[model samples]
Target: MTKELLTGNTAVALGARLSGVEYVPAYPITPQTEIIERLSRWANEGAMDARVVTMESEHSMLTAAGAASVAGVRTFTATSSQGLLYGFEMLYNIAGWRAPLVLANVSRGVASPITLEPDHNDVLSARDSGFLQIHAETCQEALDSVIMAYRIAEDDKVRLPAMVNLDGFYLSYTREPVDVPEQERVAEFLPPYRPQSGYMSAKNPMSVAVVVLDGRAYSYFKYQMHLASTNALAVHEKVAGEFEKAFGRKYPAVEGYMLEDADYAIVITNSLTTTARAAVQEMRKEGKKAGLVRIRLVRPFPRQQVADMLAGKKGVAVFDQNISVGSGGILYPEILSALYHRSDRPKKVVSFIGGLGGKRVGHTEFRHMVAVTEGCVRDDSQLASVLLFTDSDWQAVKGMLRTAGKGEVSQ
Candidate 1:
């Protein structure tokens, strides 16, 4: 066991090195470039036995990763925001072919009018692309999840690509103390890659990721993908348990902090949970019962665990860094769907959209989010609204709403 202060990118690099990744397809993108740089330095120094391929673009980068993994090498890659989108086709192709490649997605905001900041939109957009998605809340998890992603991706029952995402600027550059296990221990936990079925050879040639038959075949393929994702929930827990046996830490799909006896709670993901934790602590000190649920695994949705955690609470607030256009927030609908069928549910479930485009979400802003939820619990008529925007923006929003009223058109 070795403890070192490292930025999230370095931790991921160290984790990949420890996991004995044999190949890395490198492409530079903001927030994720440091990871490739560190891995290249390690490879150059002979610290890791890996081939680093500098590709011209993300599309080529992922294609190389998929090809390398299919060639029976444990492969890894990193990308962000538009980079992921640019290589979207390769992502689906990798999963469709059941190729196990580990992807470290340093979460960055998507572009219309672009800004490089931490947001979930980029990763969330790929939620349906048949890859296992895990969101990291800390530098340690960012490191640990990479190792787990490899294990999960290679499992015979869930043979698919895996993506481990960390918030862009907040986590990628933030320095924190991380425990990087010895290479021997990591090897013991995650053994060297052994592909279940060897790659395409002249003796056993096969077409990988070819287009399938009709709608029935397509539906069957999708159904099998769903089953794989569903099976991943249990695989994740088992892998986390195994990781705990090797390292002294355990992580769950959904982690609840002080939720057992709390009257209200906030659900969050990524680095924002750290800020929300402080707010929850203050609320606890004031004798106002508030707890927090941080989702480590976003895809496969952890519906059961989340429903159980929020059951019987007075109020629940979900904070999303990404919006779904006219909808409240992306995670908001999922959380609501999770709790909808439950007989006993939180009194008021509110959605608060904040921290878009890497905007700072301070303790004050978190407190305001909590206050809004509290008000909704008290008077059930507060009406759903997005928090942490300027008052002038609300005026503009109101004008748009009025002009676009129920089938109304603007000239």
Candidate 2:
């Protein structure tokens, strides 16, 4: 077992190499550029026996990747927020064709007013785009999930594209100790590329990715994508078990910390879970039974597992870095959906939106979220979604409410 400090981008490159990918077509984008850069260097140095294609834009990148995958090569690529949207059509094409390629998306906040920061909007925007999504909390998972993605995507039962996501500045730029498994061991785990249908051979001359389906046929094809994504929930657990047996570490789709006897918990994803962990520890130190649940896989969602872990808790504070426009937060409703039918559901779930556009989320802010959760539990009449701001405007609004209530009562 060899351990080295590697940034999340390098870890992904290493994982792709280990997965025996034979082709990479990508364009340079901030936060995600380093992933392609390292892969290109590895291919050039013959460390990886893969062909690296530099594309003019994200659209061309996916186009080439899809074509290469159809040509019977294990293909890989990386992109960011706007790049993902730019290549959005090709994402559906890749999945519709049942091409089993693995793509890494370094999660960046989407733009109107542009800023490079970690947010789920970039990835969430592709939720229904027929790709299996895996969100990584640490550098290790970022690497490990890439290997698992290939296995899940290429499985004969579930041949579909997969996206392994890491936060932009948080995991992408941050360096951490990662255990890179030996090449021979990885080879045993991930075999060479064997395309489902041998492409470009004299034995088969057929049109690849041609649109010739009727409306009902198209709906059936799309339903197949849903089946593949749903299959990932079990496949993830199976692969994680195998990975732990090989690497001495176990990764759950969604991991819960200190919730065995806790009264309340916080549910979050990616690097923010680290901040939540610290806050949970401090809250526990003060005799509050606070805990955390970190979501490692977002696409398959692990809905049953999440519901089982969080059921019967006093309350849950959901922190999301992405907003759903009219909805409070993307994850807030998902959590509620999971717990809605439970007999012992959490009394209240307070949704707190923060860290949009890559703003830093400190432990103090996480602690404040916990305090808000505590207040919600104490007083059941509070609003479901609370937008935390740096100023006291909310307090002023509360005072005005009190004044109006008193006047109405006197009348």
Best by lDDT: 1
Q: Write the residue-wise lDDT of candidate 1 on 173-269 in tens digits.
A: 9999999898888898897788866575557677875677777888887888889989999999999999888898999999999899998899999
- Superposed model 1: Cα runs more than 4 Å off: 392-411
User: What CA RMSD would you report for each candidate?
Assistant: 4.6, 6.2
Q: Per-residue lDDT of 1-411 in model 2, one digit per residue for the tens?
A: 689999999999999999988899989999999999999998999898989989899999999898778778899999999999999999988887788899999999888878888788999888878788888888998998899888888877778889999999899999999999998988877777778855654467777656755688777777877888888888888888988888877888889999999988889988778878988898889998988888888887788999999998988889998988887899888998999999988888889988888877888778887788778888875675666666554566466768878432221
Q: Candidate 1, 269: how far from true, in Å?
A: 0.4
lDDT of 1 at 128: 88
User: Model 1, 129: alpha-carbon shift in Å?
Assistant: 0.4
Best by TM-score: 1
Candidate 2 stretches greater than 4 Å from native: 198-203, 208-214, 382-384, 392-411
Clash totals in order:
0, 0
Worst 10 residues of 1 by lDDT: 402-411
